[model samples]
Target chain A: MPTFRVELFEGRTVEQKRQFVEAITKATCESLKVEPGSVDIILVDVKKEDWATGGRLWSDAG
Target chain B: MPTFRVELFEGRTVEQKRQFVEAITKATCESLKVEPGSVDIILVDVKKEDWATGGRLWSDAG
Candidate 1:
């Protein structure tokens, strides 16, 4: 089993987070052939200045 | 700012989870001294049969 950890800017609604979790769960279950309940996903919402990709914070890059 | 992600087998209560989060937040704040608001932590809970550590599933290892 595999777990996905996602961190992004904190602007999405709870509904969006719910849908995203559902989608990631579905894809992981299908791709990994694990039971849906076996997959775990964690979403961390952060401010634009807090999260980084490629060593550049979101706010800095944007 | 940095994000801390922890994945553990499911069993902790809400209060325990809250305390663990707070502990991590405090430690990060003290060590990194980033604004408390700038740090985020994501906790992922998985079934015993689903999670693996050191290349062994929890159920397999335990």
Candidate 2:
């Protein structure tokens, strides 16, 4: 079973999340040949202050 | 190129997360020989209702 953990910015609606999980489950089933129920996707929301790139926090960057 | 996605219960403090990332980064560097900056770890906090195992939701089981 291949579980997907997606990290992105917050402020998404429930409808968006429902569509996203459905699409991802379908794609995963098609490619991996696994059942939709077995595919687990966890979405993580990262704030600008919590994320960093190139040794600089995103909040600090312009 | 090794990114870690950890799914667990929420309610952890910033100090805990800071320590967690540091430890994970250190371990990854030692084992995979990847730099701290190269490793990214995304933590996913899963609600009991969202997680299911053995055809039963965690929230429903309890």
Candidate 3:
């Protein structure tokens, strides 16, 4: 199984996160032909000051 | 900074997830008193069949 870590700008809803998880899960499952239960999804949240994008902090950059 | 892997039942939206990331990031920064740029957040999504919760598949259980 392949593990993916997504980094992006903050400001989303629980529903939105759920969709992302579901979409990726389905995509991975089908592509890998592995059982859904065999997959694992983890969510890590980062703050603007703690995140960096384009050589700048997420908070400062975005 | 500590890396957290959150495993939960899927069915969230992108917006919802954004909020989660923000909240956790802020909390972690304050708790650790680390720069926001130092933190890294990743999101992983798993399908129902690939996820298991409470001894059952996430898709089948939920």
Off by over 4 Å in 1: A1-62, B53-56, B60-62
- Compute the TM-score of each model's chain A versus the native chain A and list the values: 0.78, 0.82, 0.74
Q: Candidate 3's residue-wise lDDT over A1-62, tens digit each?
A: 56555554556555566677777778778888887666655444557788775788766763
Q: Could you say which candidate leads in DockQ?
A: 2
Across residues B1-62, which tens digit of lDDT does each residue of candidate 3 receive?
57776654467899989999899899989989988887778765544544332223345443
Clashing pairs in 2: none
Q: Quote model 3's TM-score.
A: 0.45
Alpha-carbon shift of residue A61 in model 1 (angstroms): 7.3
Chain B TM, per prediction: 0.81, 0.81, 0.72
lDDT on C-alpha atoms for all candidate structures = 0.64, 0.74, 0.65
Query: What is the lDDT, from 0 to 100, of the residue B56 in candidate 1?
Result: 84
Per-residue lDDT of A1-62 in model 1, one digit per residue for the tens?
Answer: 44556565677678776765665555444433458876676777778787666888878974
Tell me each candidate's TM-score.
0.49, 0.54, 0.45
Could you report the Cα RMSD, in angstroms, for every candidate shown? Answer: 14.1, 6.9, 11.7
Cα deviation of B55, candidate 1, in Å: 5.9
> How does chain A of candidate 3 score by TM-score against the true chain A?
0.74
| Candidate scoring better on DockQ of 2 and 3 | 2
* Each candidate's fnat: 0.05, 0.05, 0.05
